[model samples]
Target chain A: MEAIILQILNGLDKGSAYALIALGLTLIFGTLGVVNFAHGALFMIGAFCAVTLQRLLNLSHEVIDDTKKDFLGNPLKVDVPYLADWFGADAAQTIIQWSVPLAILFSIPIMILVGISMERGLIKHFYKRPHADQILVTFGLAIVLQEIIKAFFGANPIPTPAPPAFTGSFDFGALIGMENIIYPYWRMVYFAFAMVVIAGVFAFLQFTTFGMVVRAGMADRETVGMLGINIDRRFTIMFAIAACVAGLAGVMYTPINSPNYHMGMDFLVISFVVVVVGGMGSLPGAVLAGFVLGILEAFASMNEVIDIVPGINQIIIYLVAIIVLLTRPRGLMGRKGVMEE
Target chain B: MLGLATKDFVLLLVVAVLCLFAPVLLNPFPETSDLAQFNAGYPDLMQRFVIFGIFAIGFNILFGLTGYLSFGHAAFLGVGSYSVVWMFKLLNYNIVPGLLLSLVVSGLFALAIGYVSLRRSGIYFSILTLAFAQMSFALAYSVLTPITNGETGLQVYGNDPQYLQGDSAPNIPHLFGMTMRATETVEFGPWLWQFNAGYYFCAVVMLIAFYLAIRIFRSPFGMMLRAVKSNQQRMRYTGLNPRPYTLAAFVISGMYAGLAGGLMASMDPLAGAERMQWTASGEVVLMTILGGTGTLIGPVLGAGLIKYLENILSKINDNILHQWFAFMPDGLEDFLVAIVHPFIGKGWHLTLGLVFMAVVIFLPGGLVEGGQRIGRLFGRKKPAEAEAKAAAKTPAE
Candidate 1:
């Protein structure tokens, strides 16, 4: 039982990422009626935002520390970050340590700007095009985005560490009178962060007039236009929001998995599977599917399970996707006439 | 002339001429020239061009004619490669059996994948194919280690059984006794041109594949496939089952992909899991779309252009850029190199991506259409009307 719980816990962080990305993808699909393949690139850009912040915080200058002399010499040269000069050394140290979290704020504006520009400049033209063209064009965008990222950051995975405070694991085994049920504090934080964001998005959509209009627009774009509502503009904003959400997921994800240029692509196929399994254009379904698949993948990877099935973990999600797609073509919660054409 | 319409026959002849003389044509620069880096007349790269040409051509048959965007096409390519390599491991080093085996294996594989995936249309079909591909890749990488040789990839080892091995047989892949890597270089003036056995063989195969594609494009069955693409529901309303036609196209394309894969292994005796990755599948899609999705020669052109660019652009590092701009002022030269930096060397994908996006956006018809548009600008007649005239005179030709 403890082992099972531990597995579920292990799954949550990855699940949270899938849910976040799929939620964004579903939003773009539901509102704009566009299949945004570059959504994964948006997540990657978000992770780089964290990397960017760390780089910014660590921008340094060489200073001569007369107090600390080198073996050969007059004065030891010390590299001092500009942050240490602006805010004292202790504050600068803390800020650099917490740069990944701080990147959340940094990436939001950048992600929104990117989303807005992407929708306005490129995807807007493809709205009336076939889904194939949309897919191809967005796929092109994804490649360009990742290539640009690769050009800037180089090909290596940049390890973005969590704050010193959350480095250790939280023991849950002792609480339940069990052994070895400990979980990482950062992972738990990730799950909580995901829940908060998911709730925030739901609440924003549920309680606000803007959300209601967007939802109605998704239901009937023509009807919404007849009502004199500028559905297109709202959909564009929604695209930005979705991009922002994906970006946040990436920003938080860096500590869990090192932020590589191809990380977005690595997650992309799995996330697409998540969205398909959840049901295209279904927000709640996307989230639910994400968590379920993540946990299942965790279970599938277990040594006991692998002994029986042999390499089931590597393909369990795809297997489930195939089975689900064959059985339930509309997905777990897809609406009618969404992508039938 | 091989039952082709006069216009298509002319196009076929032109393609044949290009393929036949590629070694000479591609070696436009002298060996001693600074532009030597741009030459793709070598065996390995030329093989890739033709192999990928065959791949894109096969892809075009499905995606171009049927409008089925299969995202897992590389699965067949990988399967073909594995079959060929296995043949090498078990049988003789001759490529004949391996290539034939590849086509058969990939065809069967495609049939099975298509049977299930064709049940859904649009995005679902694509996702299904992708899922199946990822599964195969995973299996090949891990569980199928005995067959696939896992991460190290399947290769001929000293201990491996070679039932058809003989004292006279060459160890490398061959067509009977003629090794695939056999090359003859001729120097005329300062230019050096290579005539490679493998490239010529692959080029011959590509030409045959191209001719067959042309035949398929003009046939009544091809029209039916096009009709299916335009409106499957309408075909169904006409009391026609489009499934068999689609499944047939899928399998045909799969065989073509497998054939390409087989040729790849024939050129170089190694097959790895990466061959089945979605990115490899995406490359064929990129080639087909970038060339011209529905056109006869678009995929070939796209494949050649991409492969050439990959070979040439990747060699243009910062130093090369600096050298090219050396005649300018120091600051200007440095600035130019910096500006050109991101689109060359390791950054060629960025340029390719941007070009792909532009092609999809402004010129959806691809490079073939782009060529037609340029031709139209300088012509006395529109090609569409000329095509009608040619069709009228087709019986005589």
Candidate 2:
């Protein structure tokens, strides 16, 4: 029972990432009718935003300390961060410590701008083109974006630590009347964060008049346009919103896995599998499948399962995707005629 | 000539001449020239050009004709390589049997994948194929390590069973007694050219593959495949089954990829799981689109262009950039070199991405359309009519 609960907990964090990325992907596909291959690149840009903020806060100038000798027997050149000089050492240190959370604010505007420009500049022209062309163009865009990141950052994963307050594990065994059921605090925080974000997105779409019109537009764009609604403008805003969600997910995920240039690509194909399994344009299904597959993957990775079938964990998600696709052609919640042909 | 149309005969002859004298044609620079680094006439690169040309040509047959965008074709290539390596391990060092086995194995693999994937059309089909390929790649990297040799790749050893081998059996892959790596260099004046046995062997195979692709393009079966691409519903209403034709095209292309893979293994005698990655599959797709999808010879051109760029452009470092801009003023030279530095060498992918985007957006017919447009610009024909014709020819969907 404890193992099951632990596996579920383990699955939740990975599922959160998959859900967030798939949400963005489905949103773009739902609203703009585009398969944005560069969506992963946007998520990558979000993680880098946190890295950028962290680096910015830690911008240091050299200070010679006569008390400490260097390795070469000279006076030690202790680097004092500019933030420490300006805001006093304690406050600047605290701010730098909380850079990951702070990056949410930093990434929002940047991600929106990127989303808007991507929609306006390159993807706008491709709206009428074939899906193949869209995929090709966006794939090209993805390569360019990833290569640009690689050039700037080099190809290494930069570790970004979480705040000291959330570094350790929480012993849930005592509360649950079970032994050794400890879970990491940051992972629980991530799960809570994901829940809030998912709920917020659903509430926004359900409650707002703007969202109602957008939903109507998704169902029938031409009819909504005939009723004189500016659906295109709303859809573009939705695209930006989707980009924000993906960016926020990336920002928060840096503490879990160190941010790297190719990290987006690592997530991209799997997220694509998640999207397909969830049914092409179904948002709820995307979230549902994400968690389900995540748990399935966790279970598959267990020693017992590996003993039964070696290397099942490496291919479990894809195997599930294939089986699901073959059996359920429209996916779990997909509407007919959306990419059915 | 050879029962082909006049245009096709001329094209074949041109291609033949080009392949036969590629060493001389590809190496225009003198032996000691500074531009020698740019020459791609060496055996390794030349072999790659034809091998990848074969791969791309096969991909074009399926994608250009059917408009079914497969993202798992490289799996077949990997399968071919693995099968050939196994043949080399178990049998003698002869390439013929290994190549044949590669075709059979990959063809069977393709048949299985295509049968299932072809059930769904459009993007779903693409996803299905991608899943299969990813699964295959994962297996090859992990549990199948006994067969695939995992990250180190599958290679031959001295103790491996070679039942057909004699006392003097060559360790390297060969056709009869001739080694695949055998090369002869000839010098004319200041120019030097290398003639490689492996390259010629691959070039001949590439020509044959190209010829088969041309025949397929002109055949009635090809027309049926195109019809399926244009409108499957209409074809179904006309009482024609599109599945068989599509499956056949898929298998044929898979065999071609397998052949290319076998050739690759024959040249290097190793098989790595990385060859089956989706990125490698994307490379072939990029080659086809960049070269011009539907046109004959376009895929080969695309393959050669990409391979040449990959080999030559990647060798240009910061020093090379600085050297090129040394004639400028100090500040200007530094600025120019710095600006040009990132998009070369390690940053070649960025340049390639930008080029690919430009091709897809501006010239949907790829380089062929661009060339046609330029040709029309020089001629007396009105540009508007030519533009319309070109637009009409392109399958927009």
DockQ of each: 0.86, 0.88
- Per-residue lDDT tens digits for candidate 2, residues A1-341, read 88888888889899999999999999999888999999999999999999999999899999998999978999998999999889999999999999999998999999999999899888888878889898999999999999999999889999999998899999988888998789888888888888888888888988999889989988999999999988989999999999899999999999999999988888888898899999999999899988888888988888888999999999999999988899999888888878788
Across B1-397, the per-residue lDDT of candidate 2 in tens digits comes to: 6766666666776788999999999999897988888888889999999999999999998999999999999999999999999999999889999999999999999999999999988888888888899999999999999999999999999899888987786779998878999999998999889999999999999999988887888788989989989999999999999999999999999999999999999999999999999999999999999888877777888899999999888999988878878888999999988888889998999999999999998988787777677766777655334432333344333
TM-score of chain B of 2: 0.96
- For model 1, residues B1-397, the per-residue Cα lDDT tens digits are 9999778887777778888999999888999999988899888899999999999999999999999999999999999999999999998899999999999999999999999999998888888999999999999999999999999999999887889988899999999899998999898999998999999999999999999998998999898989889999999999999999999999999999999999999999999999999999999999998888888778888999999998899988999888889999999999999999999999999999999999999988787767666656777666443432332221100
For each of the candidates, give the backbone clash count: 0, 0
lDDT value, residue B124 of candidate 2: 85
> Which parts of model 1 are misplaced by more than 4 Å?
B381-397
lDDT of 2 at A267: 89
TM-score of 1: 0.97
User: On residues A267-333, what C-alpha lDDT tens digit does candidate 1 reach at each position?
Assistant: 8889999999999999999999999999999999889999999999999999999999999988898
